[model samples]
Target: MLFKKTATFITAIMLSFAALFTPFPSHAEAHATNSYQSLENTINAILSDASIKSAMTSVTVRKASTGEIVYEANADRKVTPASTLKLLTAAAALETLGEDYRFTTDVLTDGTISNGVLNGNLYLRGQGDPTLMKKELDQFAATLSKLGVKKINGDLVGDDQWFDNIRLSPSIDKSDETYYYAAQISALTLSPNADYDAGTVIVDAKPTKKGYKPKISVTPDEGIVTIVNKANTVAKGKRNTLSIKRQHGTNKIMVSGNIPVGSSKREWVTVSNPTAHTLAIFKSSLSSKGIKFSSTSKNVRRQAPDTAKVLAVHKSMPLKNLMIPFMKLSNNTHAEILAKTMGKKVYGEGSWNAGLRVMHEYATSIGLDASEWHFEDASGMSHKNKVSSAQLTELLLLVRNAPWYGSFVKSLPISGIDNRFVGGTLRNRLASPSVKGKVIAKTGSLNNVKSLAGYAETKSGETLVFTILTQDHKDSTLPSIDKIATAITTTPIY
Candidate 1:
């Protein structure tokens, strides 16, 4: 089946070349009038702006149906892709796991249940489902209650062996441990809310009495997180500034700042130990359901015993359903989870090294030259990752023929759309009516890197795939990138 599809793709590419070299009468006339040359000059003017003269820029546009290059400028020069790398990860996931793949979280026990007591330890085994919620944990607790297990004689163990023990990527910035974007990745993790942000919690600070310390609270209120508040509420109109940080090697969050009277501040902070946080939340949920544990919960690195019996289970929505949030919000955790999961599924080892190997193999098999791109991490958060505009466009064209292509494209952020989740990272971008809703792409941004890549509908009703990567520019280059997209989307029929 794979070979048959590959042949089809190869044949399509050949046909595109045949058409490009054999121009129609009208196209010949347009060439005589220098239409293509005129467009090239216009695009080159934008790319050569003085502000971005020193930066590395890679741009490529190709006709989706024909696989013919329409425009190119340093397209083969490698540049950091940032979040746009998610496109590669997402495509690999669809191929490896399929659209119907689902993750399951299970409750198991190694002890026998007699009368109203469980004589041994209760194990919570996680399958690395990123969408697990407090409500689902509540359901697990309810199940225990229904089973008449009121007490656990042994420890409440959190089994996170589904993946390796590594939590945060070493390449990520280590100074700010509280930033939710850099949250830890764990097999057993908990997201505070529907944003599906795992390994983090929300901290809200509100003023209490004038000249006194402000009160702090965390949402979903079940996880165990300690907040050391040293903030004060000052007189009205006073400057409001707040600082929130999680101490190294512990789950202690320090919040120090001043908020004017009647003002409130909020932030989403990462948790130091996500396994402990999950266990804490589960234990609390069990307590609310009238269940108790004799000892504190602990992390269990090993797999559950064979003698263990199943108590309750929760399965996540299919992979196809998750693509929307995963891609729309540019969720780093999702990318990492999928990468590790792919590694585990294909090689029986759930590490980044193993997963990235599979990703490279897949990309190469689909016509993207392996030498043209290098990926260090699935989320593109690593500065070591590099890919050329030509490679990204080749990937886009190859995947357009895949069975899951529609869902994959829909997962991208649409340009000019006003909807938050729908518009995603591109919601406010390309707002001009001429371009709005005409382009769908993935966005990438780092300290001084910006990238956008995906599909654009040209005025002639042809679909074009494009990629724009700009790095180390001192000024904003988004406007220039937008103009490039506009040209591709508005390309004349000829």
Candidate 2:
């Protein structure tokens, strides 16, 4: 159901001394006026545009220092927040796991090494580390090589018991199975690149001689995926339309379409079975080290026997360092991995329900009203998630004073920045001289939902925490949203 709340204005507020640097008239003279009507008018005018006539929007702005409600409209209503929900997840992770936490991937064996002919299963275990790459797994193989005994007489096993078997959320669309952004989660998984996109691979198609089939390759060059090429090379001036997709429930990727003779294209496709993907990569890495195992006959799930010996382990970068790519790029896999890790840490289980419970408990402890929000998954990919603007702003205010605030804020994508590492999704947004570098917020977008929430530093140097969510808007609502953000920064202090 759609809902809206009339704008609320809190008056008789003492002017903040930080207003000295404000671009408006002198602070004292502006204080004499004692009203935020102009700012409200500017924001309202943008919202009243014909493009959002039927859209439901909620906005709330509060003084970061005093928690004063500077302006609010429908702030109490619940709305889908898209990726902006990462703000809450990131904060919860920092608080629950601490900034120094790390994820570890280990290699072990159930049998002893003897005379180069040990006869037992070699198990690869994971702790839901999203950043596991081929290089790290190769290091494990190298360590095994240095251990002196190398012939395995049993099937290679993958142990993913750290988390439940449910790899993908039930609510996620089945059609998205091939998209890397909606990759499956596993305690043991392979990321295609350093971006840490777990459970996915990069498919590269390059044009060959005209009239010949295009050459196809997959990154990390693992034999895990089966590529079926139906693509053709066309004349240099022909259209370069191409389509790459993984068949449902399998790792059979179909590459089709025309590629101009000199062109090349790439697609990041999700792997159907994350465990198998990890095992394959590890096996490949092992063979590269001249270490050969007895059989590729069977790859199954099993626990590392108590007698198993530790071979080698790879520890991920600290959680604080991971926050940059996770938050900056809005990585869904990282979010899910951290959620399960939290569950494992707090409840001895690594399921979403248990992890979300920990996050919920943390939220309540921090003073957010329970009725104001609900978390369906750590990542905001699920549409079932809902949160009120007031809840977001309040949470923002609370975290600003937390011990981990420094790392958390640095993780956020900054505005007006062109570098992907710096600007993230907001790099090109809000670039106006007055707004650029002045606002640091998270951006969320889905079918018809758009949300922006975070802190904005005004010309007066007053820090304001705000959230703006628009639902059911068909037309591009970013400009209007940008206007609202700009309004908050330029709004005179009265």
Candidate 3:
């Protein structure tokens, strides 16, 4: 009996040792391992396609709920991010400026009203309100008229010193200056429409008849730009190859090309000087409102005096509302304006340098190493801007818990949606049934670069944050990129 007991004890000790040395995976661990392998196979197969085979590509995917990275391909390699850099700008803006911040434009006077005549300068001070429209100026003029000021004996001064006098970003190509997307940035500016395309005017060309000059018109008709119509109307079925270009450093828009007899063409041209443009429109509005300027009144650009009293003020929609257009349309002017505004608010200086410093600091506070990336301009218009896919995915993951995350995510362009404001740039792309409405991301394109980065809902109900950055390809790589996103959305994560 004693011998049998000793043998049993030895057997039990051996069994315990065997269990410790060779353990079985729990159900959760097995699922995660299989999921990781499946995701890798799927993404790798998509990346091998001929469309993006020659291009430099970087991809990164992470679980939204937890910070665990599920897949990555050269994710640490830094490359130009194009407009995807807007993701960083959007997050930093929301975190620093808050969702309720509003830009303000004010009309102030240094002189007292006496018998319907003001003896001092009527100052128009702008604090970077890009949504200022012609109607707003008309309203300003009407306010002055209602206040019983029929004439001003002083100059109509424009105070655009709220931001620096730099009109265009240093990284903008010379050829792009005449286009609306590269519109000048100023504290005072005007947008012709509700799209809030500030510092630009709409040039509409309606074909009058064949073999004749097309009828051309500029919106607002404020005389801020000179129209040099050089286009002619062609036969009804002829190719409508109309071209509109603004001269360098001037508002002389040169319209050239052929338009079908019945077809119309429109282009958004950037103005030469935004501050001057705003002043001219305001002057026109004053005249329309029957508020006349005295013979001695001179229209000029000057700062508002310290003694000036506010006569009228217009506050822009909160930053939350502005994000819809800024992110949806990828407005470069708005991004830069917000950058300078952040700088001015945080460091008392409204300059790109100051604003970028603020952004860099915010990035560091959120676990990003500032030294790993470089951004010359907030809008990613600069070719010098470089960042890694991993960095962008990390940013998306970290900001998920922010108080303003809802507003930030809502601003992203949704895939397969038809509404201009709702689907944004991604409306026509990624329309596959399984992927449609499953991806919300930002689309980016520069000369030879294209990128897509945002969130995707997987088949297993897991939210994935992904970034795909591609550059240096001769052909279009968007198809392959979209395929990758589709795979991410359809692949089971569990």
Question: How many clashing residue pairs are found in candidate 1?
Answer: 0
Tell me the spans in candidate 2 whose CA falls farther than 4 Å from its real position.
1-35
Backbone clash total, candidate 3: 0
> TM-score of model 2 relative to the true fold?
0.91
Give each prediction's root-mean-square deviation over alpha carbons.
7.2, 7.6, 13.0
**Which 10-residue window in model 2 sums to the lowest lDDT?**
24-33
Alpha carbon deviation, residue 51, candidate 2 (Å): 2.0
Candidate 2 per-residue lDDT, tens place, 1-494, comes to: 11222232011011221321122211110111226567777777877888765788889877665677777888888889888888888988999999999988898887778877657788999998888898898888888888875677888899999998878765579988899888999999888887889989999999999888999999878857999999899999899988999999989999988999878999999998899888988889888887788755467887787778888788889999899889888898898888888998999999989888888888898878866778688888877789988889888777876788877877777667666766688988987767766677888888888889988877677777789988877786787888899998887766
RMSD of 1: 7.2
Q: Each candidate: how many clashes?
A: 0, 0, 0
- Model 3, span 1-494: residue lDDT tens: 01222565445333422322231221110113455777789889888888788899889987665556778889889988999999999999999999999999999999989998887889999989888899999999999999998888889999998888777778988999999889998998899998899999999999987889999989878857999988999999999889999999888999999999878988999998888889999999998877889887877998998889999999999999999999988888899999989998999888899889989999999888788779988999888889999899888877776788878887888787666786789979987767766788998999889999998877765677799999999998898999889988787655
Candidate 3 clashing pairs, residues 3+ apart or interchain: none
Worst 10 residues of 3 by lDDT: 22-31
Span of ten consecutive residues with least summed lDDT in model 1: 23-32
- Candidate 3: C-alpha RMSD after superposition: 13.0
Maximum-lDDT candidate? 3
Which candidate tops TM-score?
Answer: 3
